[model samples]
Target: MLADVQKALDAFGEREINRVFFVGCGGSSSIMYASKYVMDRESTSLASDLYSSNEFIHRNPRQLGPESLVILCSHYGKTPETVEAASFAREKGALTVSLTFDPDAPLAKASEYVIIYEDGKQGGTFANEAPAIMLELVLGLLSSKEGNTKLDELLPSLENLRGIIDGEKAKSLAAAKAFAEAYQDDKVIYTMGSGANYGIAYWFSICLLMEMQWIHSHALHAGEYFHGPFEILDEQVPVIQLVGLDETRPLEERSLEFTQRYGKRIIVIDAKEFDLEGVAPSLRGYLAPLVMQAVLRQYAEELATARNHPLTTRRYMWKVAY
Candidate 1:
């Protein structure tokens, strides 16, 4: 399952490159952000660029050159918008790398490099998203010589998470089941995350919509909870918090309190359940989100199934046509 991804990492590690531009849409776009965040926290090996496929095709005007390598993220090479970006990247003379399940996928055919994730065949939304997360970790590890930086340090734990979540009867099912029931009636899903977990917020919403659910969900930066989003909270509304162990615990705690102030409950999913006051301040933030992401992913799926809905109503993320 991981064979192509492993090869992609080895290939990426050997590159003597300059600028790195990461381009993907929807779940695939998270890969670009994850890569940027991981590298920014540790080193300056390469200057990185992150762009959504639509933006890259319609709005972004940056130059793509031989000196720059574009990490093109798409689970299905058939996604027209991303495939267009893939074509554009090629025409611009930039080296392209892709992470996908099929080695011969149109997206893979469009890149100079390709990585495949064989976890399971059809996750729909989950399919492309998981590979992006997995490859980002692997690429982060291969980037350094010490191989002991924060990114490398967390790779094993992240890998373990992918394994656990891959199973149908994983331990996270129970928690996921419970959480889903709590918000079954919610009109919107507010996924909150801090520090590295920012990507998680997006990851969760993507899964809920793709895992055969029709929920309208959006991501919130953890500390940014103070924004007007707090304006629409009440007993009928719930704000699910992705509380991880990280340097930003104090900030997360403050947000937790703020959510409760709106008369809403704060559900913190971490390595283990604990009283909010007793959780660690400086925590192991890396792997905590993976476990919960898996748990909540299932909950999101169950909620949609109970309501008789398919992952998302739209054929794709066509948010607008005007």
Candidate 2:
């Protein structure tokens, strides 16, 4: 799949690509944030932006033309808005690439370059997931445009992601169970992180906690903790702080310091705790969020079990038209 991603980028040519747009919705939209963050930090000449599929179409940036690359994603590739976004991008003369599990999906048909990721329902490893694929695309762009060598070092680690993620998930189970036992009755859960991990916090808050578990939640940026959100903190509030190994570590640490003073029920999922045996030190920052995500999955699983509400339970998601 990485080879396919590279081939797509190579065919597009670095000289022809000046801007990038990532478009999706819900969890798909959340997962692309890390890539956009990486691109923003690493690429000097390239411009990148992320948007929900509908918004991408609605805003219709004037820069959406021949020199632009639009990457869209959908788990099953049938998301109506995402498919429409793909077609919209194509109509605007931008090179359109898409990541999806279904090759025959509407999104795939709508894209010019389609990368089919492994379906999680079919035992796909984290290496083959959307985030990993998108990260590789971002690395590919960096390598082609800015001469980044990190991708070469990161590829081997990405290959070993399955074992690393499994080990971390195993280590996280005890903590997840403990969290489930302690915070089961809490009505609203708060998630916080900075840099790349913010997307994981966002996904956990919306997709797992609120959407799946029927709990109210909000994702707070660690950098914005002191602005207004910290006023809501108290010993009774349940806050999950995701600390990643990125440049934004200090921001999370700062928030953690303040959070520890007032919030008694804080669950810290720090990436530093994971050994990440084979992963290179240079790539840890880029890969930490995926590790954090795997750990959060265990928390969601245990919490759903503790609440006796299966994660698959949904009231108005697929049942009613929004």
**Candidate with the greatest TM-score versus the true structure:** 2
Q: Write the per-residue lDDT of candidate 1 for residues 1-322, one digit (tens) a residue.
A: 2455556556656765567777887766763554566555554456766788778878655756666667776776666777778778778777677766567788877777776654444533232345435545434544543354444434444434434455523655676667667766666667777775667678776655433465677777766667776666676565677676655656667777777676655566654452222212222454445545556667676776656665566654556552
lDDT of 1 at 309: 65
Superpose all Cα atoms of candidate 1 onto the true structure and report the RMSD in Å to 1 decimal.
5.2
Model 1 lowest lDDT segment of ten: 274-283
Q: Estimate the overall C-alpha local distance difference test score of candidate 1.
A: 0.60
The whole-model C-alpha lDDT of candidate 2 against the native structure comes to 0.89
- Clashes (backbone N, CA, C under 3 Å), per candidate, total 3, 0
Regions of candidate 2 where Cα sits further than 4 Å from its true position: 1-3, 120-125
Count residue pairs with overlapping backbones in model 1.
Answer: 3
What local lDDT does model 2 show for residue 42? 87
lDDT, model 1, position 259: 76
Off by over 4 Å in 1: 1-3, 6-14, 61-63, 121-159, 162-172, 206-212, 272-284, 310-322
TM, every model: 0.77, 0.97
lDDT of each: 0.60, 0.89
